[model samples]
Target: MTAAPAFPPLVEAYLADLEHALAASEPRERAETLAAVREHAAESLALHGSDDAGARRVLDELGPVDAIAAASTPAAPAAAGAPAAPAATPAADVWLVVLAVASLALFVVPLVAAAAVIWAVVRLRAGVGNRRVQTLALAVGTVSLVGAAALYVSHVLAG
Candidate 1:
């Protein structure tokens, strides 16, 4: 096996700080910020002479960890404007009901539907609204239900 490339101490510290900052950020912004940090580190390593002092200097120039985290995070809307109204609780309940109906349809359908509904509800409760999660749940539930129906029909035909 090839030997792993070693990072200088300062470079390692910078990377650790970057990781912490990325972890504290929202999921939506994480990818882009991570890419930027990775690119910057690569560029810095390439330009700097291979010396600990050089790495330290580069990291120091990059500034503090908190500043980096703040810069990477998306700014929340200013409170000057009227606050947006909360989403209707009943809508989420409706989604849960639909999920329940889909789950009752067949074998694996209920399991998949229940998982999706549970995941969406948990995310919503945690103040995360992901349209992708909702869409995935709906699609998976429908497909499973349809598959279950088709299997039942085939069995009847065979009988």
Candidate 2:
């Protein structure tokens, strides 16, 4: 078997930093991670034929000390008995827009449009409608109702 390769001071310093960063990890875990990193460095050195510059290249590929340490740490496990989260419900904006459009029937039939607008408001307050689109619907509905009322009053005055 061939003797192990000796890395330059820079590579040693990088490894030292990596070890320091991983100190909080379990001993066996830390050793395993460090060993892998060393193995990679050794292989890179062999390919480069003992060139010290290869150490920097190998360590660079291994990534920064902090990143390696962070990667080695796992997230906390969830409680065994907890229920999984439910899927999200679809937004109600489409129906709200439909109602808003229906409300514009105020020009043709004020009573129908009024009912549609009332229903839209109820949905908005109930949190069923999407806020952004519902606001635009409210504007359209209000304009249609107002225009209808104005036309009705004008017709009566002209007649």
Candidate 3:
């Protein structure tokens, strides 16, 4: 039998999409899906007996890459089953106000308070679920820190 021609590009693209979908999926689920995809691709290629046609068929069976990625991801947890939490409040606004007040008093206490604000901002940015609030807090905290530093420098220069 004549050897089938190589379809490197098509195969590579298919593999890339598969990998992307895997990455977006949960760790345990990703492993299973990856194994299934590998096996399916191999089987299709063997059955088709031509690399180009095999790759095309495999990709068609897999469906859209984005759809696969979305499917593999876990759904966001619903609030119904959990305890009744308080309604969502603008916590970031409150935090910004607190930080601003703290910043003014920080001048007498030196950088300690300013450092605390910076630390809180970093923690918020890292762990907070609300991206908008995290970003606002970070911006306000950063500005406060910079202002505090400038005040300290000016104080020393004047004295």
Candidate 4:
């Protein structure tokens, strides 16, 4: 197996600082940000030739770790005693609900409904959507899937 590319000391130190700076971010967001930044640094190193000078250049282009962390982090609540803001419903959640509802048409168009059910299940598993919406999608999608399967089995047995 090929060895993993090694970063210069400067790049490694920058990554360490970045990790510390991102400590307050959501775990998923932190991991994603770090991974993307690491990949970019690797690409930059490859382009510039892996060395302290190249790493310095890459870090310069990236700016300070604190600035990067600030850009990635969500804004703080306006007041210390104020309630945290509710997360907005993601677009994917909206689509999941649409697909789950559309699954009701399974009796008339099994393929479309099947696709909808599949999409709903995938989105629900990702756990990225609002809880209430995800629950609705899962419930509706399950019912449709079961109904479609029953209808298919009955038709097959009848013929």
Ranking of models by lDDT? 4, 2, 3, 1
Write model 3 residue lDDT over 1-159, tens digit each, in one string: 955334447766776777876674677887777667666766777777546777788778867767766778663346667876664646654665566557555645546445546656666656654545555555555666677778878989999
TM-score of each: 0.39, 0.43, 0.40, 0.49
User: For residue 92, what is the lDDT in candidate 2?
Assistant: 61
Model 1 misses residue 155 by how many Å? 95
> Which pairs of residues collide in model 2?
none
Per-residue lDDT tens digits of candidate 1, residues 1-159? 955345677777777877777675766687777667656665676688548876776677677777888876654545668797766544554565466456656444446555655655565567555555455555655566566667778889999
Better of 1 and 4 by lDDT: 4
Off by over 4 Å in 2: 1-4, 74-159
Which pairs of residues collide in model 4? none
The digit string of per-residue lDDT tens for model 2 on 1-159 reads 967557777788888999899887767889999988888888887786555677767777888898889877643335677776754433566665676687676476676556556766776788764666767767777777777788899999999
Cα deviation in Å at residue 37, candidate 2?
0.5
Q: Where in model 1 is the C-alpha error above 4 Å?
A: 1-6, 74-159
Candidate 1 accuracy as TM-score: 0.39
Model 1: lDDT to the true structure: 0.64
lDDT of each: 0.64, 0.74, 0.64, 0.82
Q: Once superposed on the true structure, which residue ranges of model 4 sit more than 4 Å away at CA?
A: 1-81, 124-127
